[model samples]
Each structure stands twice: as structure tokens, then as C-alpha cells.
Target: MEIEFFDILSKNGPVSWSPNTVKTRLCLNYLAIPHKTTYLSYPDIAKNHKSLGIPPNPKGLEFTCPAIAVKQSSKVFALQESLAIAKFLDETNSSNSDRKIFPNPGALSLALLVQRVVDRILNSPVAKIAIPKVVDILDPSGREYFIRTRTEWFGMPIDDWAGDLEIAWKNLARDVDIFSKMLVEAANGPEGGPFFMGSVPSYADFVFVGYIVWLKEANEADGESNG
Candidate 1:
């Protein structure tokens, strides 16, 4: 069955600026799943999810995007949370072993570890900078919704969050540098340049890619070179 995937819409359309949503999109792409994406704005996410019997995030927000609904013989399973959804997709579509996201038994734990560390070191700082810039590409209500909600989320206004853009980038670079050294030493790169596990792709690598995409979007929005 084709999965009904939900993604938050930007002003530009179906391409979401949210890293979590983009992460799931990449997961779906990697797995080559048959899924149709439905893009919604910020205000519409909760309504759409709730209408589909999707539960609110336990400890995070009231609702989250990047949800998927799959219909089986007798049930329609609606799942949220990118990592959980990724696990489900991998488990269900892993008949072709080589196409699996988790290459080995330890890959799951490593993915989780990378997910946590990257969220802190990379996502946190990047959000401070990239998140506000996303408003430029959102609809009017979405713009307001993002500002208000994210302000509360960050405990500061959007401008204040990235008040010193220089510091925001500096923090990202410093923490990412530290994490890079640690990650490299812990898991040495292979002959094909660099990745979390060398040449092989993993969910952990997608986590990094998601953040990179978000940063790139922000960079483009700011009319600044990534350099």
C-alpha cells in the first residue's frame, strides 16, 4: 500500500524547511517506498494529524509533521516521529537486505547515538539561525505561527534567537568541529572519502544531511554564501 506522507509546506510548496520532515523524506527516498506527499502549512499540521487519529507528540509539541499513514489489510497505521517512522519503514521493506537503512545490528544504536548528539551539537545551533529565516518562505499565517511557536520554543523572539548571527554560526562550527573529531576517531572513515560509516549510507548519515539541507536553505534565504 502507498503511504500517505505529511510534510509541512513552505512558501515554495511541498519542499519543507523542517529538518525532521526532510529527514523522513530522505528516508522514504532511500527506501524507495511508494508514498504520496501532502503538504500543509504550520497551522494545518495539528488539524490534519488529529483528523487522521494521529497522536500529539508526548514531550515535544502538540503535533508534529512528517507523519505517515499506511493501510494494511485491515488497519490504517498512522505513525509520527522521524526515527520511529524510519524504523518502521526499514522493518517492513527490508526484504531486500542491502537496501536496509540499518546495515548491521549495531547500526540502530549508532543511529540513535548520532541522532542525539547531532540534535544537540548541530541542530540546536542551526535552528537558532536557520529557523527564523524559514519564515521568508512560508505563507502569512505560517509565518506568524512559526514566529510565535518557535519564540516560545526557544524562550526568545526569532530575531533575538539569532540576534548575533555570528555567534550562532560560531557555536555551530565549534560544536560541530568537536563532534566531528570525536565521531571520526570513534568510527574511522573508509576509502570513499567521508560518511558516518564510510561509503555505506545509514540513517545517521541522513540525519546529518537533513541538517545540511536546512542550513543550505537558510544560507540561500539570507543571500549569503555558505563559504
Candidate 2:
């Protein structure tokens, strides 16, 4: 069974990052789910996303990236939103003979909680500082202002960018505590070794990896701007 995944190769204006798409791919990779990647361009993705059944304002004006279409039982299931898509991949791609993508109820719950934490970090004030700066650095002045103002509306501290940065880092630290706890739990769980659910990486690991990469990219962008 092959799955169709939409992604962007470059960060163009109005084009959303395929964080969820990347997560889905990671899950599929770890779980050994067969899939094909389709690159969606800015022109069609920006203007015709609605027609493609992608929510325009998923996560609040964060255009949906990494939408997936699954083929099953002679029908196709199209999913938008990163976390939901991850869950869908877990449920549908179970081969019945191998270790599951999500495992049992306990693992599913953990995946859900970890994804929630990802949401917090992504929307947090501190994380907001990095992306707009990257966008501003990469885009034209007018587009940069739009990105900055959007960040401002979404908890960016325009008045005290430094103060906001401090608060953002503090919030991230708080969230990281929870993440670390989860990691500890995984380390202590039965059959613990390499992954959150056990020896094999689960859907949660994929989501975790995606966010880690995103944070790293943001930090790199921040350092470049500061330099």
C-alpha cells in the first residue's frame, strides 16, 4: 500500500513548512510504511489549498503543510493537520504482522501527549522569536514586516523583543521539563532501549524528531541574525 504525502522543498512566501508532513514521513520510515512524496508548489498550494481539502488556517493561520492522502479499501482518505495525520498514519498502516506504528492504548496516549507538547512549543512566545527573524532575513522587506507583525499578533513582544525572548526561553525550558520527564518515563518503561514506546520508534518519536529539527533550525537562524 502506497501513501501520498505533500511537501515543500523550499520556504516560499505563503507556503507552509511541512513539519507534520516530515513527521509523517519519519513515522512511515521508522514503521516501514511504504509511501511516495509529492512536492507541492507555492502557486497551487497557496491558492487552491481549499480545493485540495487542506484547512487554510490550521493552527491559526499556519497554513496546512504535509497533508497526506491514503489509499485503503478502494477509497482515499485525505488528512490535514500534522498531529491528526500522524495519528491516521499510525492507525491505517498497521500491517498486522509487525510492530505497530502506535502500539497499544498506552503508547497512543503518550504519542498524543507528546504531540500536545509540540503544539505548545510551536505556539510559545519564545519559539515565535526565531521563525519571523528567519523569514525576515530570507524574505523581502514588505514580506518581512508582514511576518514580524504576524508574529507580534501571535505573542511576539514587539515592544520588548528582548524581554519577549527571555520569556519565550523560560516557557520553552518549562516545556522541556515535561519532555524530559517523558523521556525518563520511556527510559524506565518495560523493554526500554531506543524508543519512547520501547525498542522501536513510535509515532511519538517521529513527531519529537521533527520538532527538535525545527527548534534547531530556529536557533541557527537566531544565531545568524545575532551574528
Candidate 2 deviation (Cα RMSD): 4.9
Per-residue lDDT over 1-227 for candidate 1, one digit per residue giving the tens place of the 0 to 100 score: 76989988777766756788888898888888878998888899888889889888888686887899998877898978899898998989843556878877878887888888887677778887787788887888988998898888779888877777888888888888865774575466443536676666788888877888888877677588647
- The lDDT values for all models are 0.81, 0.61
- How well does model 2 score by local distance difference test? 0.61
Backbone clash count for every predicted candidate, in the order shown:
1, 1
Badly placed stretches (over 4 Å) of model 1 are: 94-97, 182-193
**Cα lDDT for residue 79, candidate 1:** 78
* Best candidate (score: TM-score): 1
Predicted structure with the largest lDDT when compared to the true one:
1
lDDT of 2 at 200: 68
Q: Report the Cα lDDT for candidate 1.
A: 0.81
Provide the TM-score for each candidate, comma-separated: 0.90, 0.69
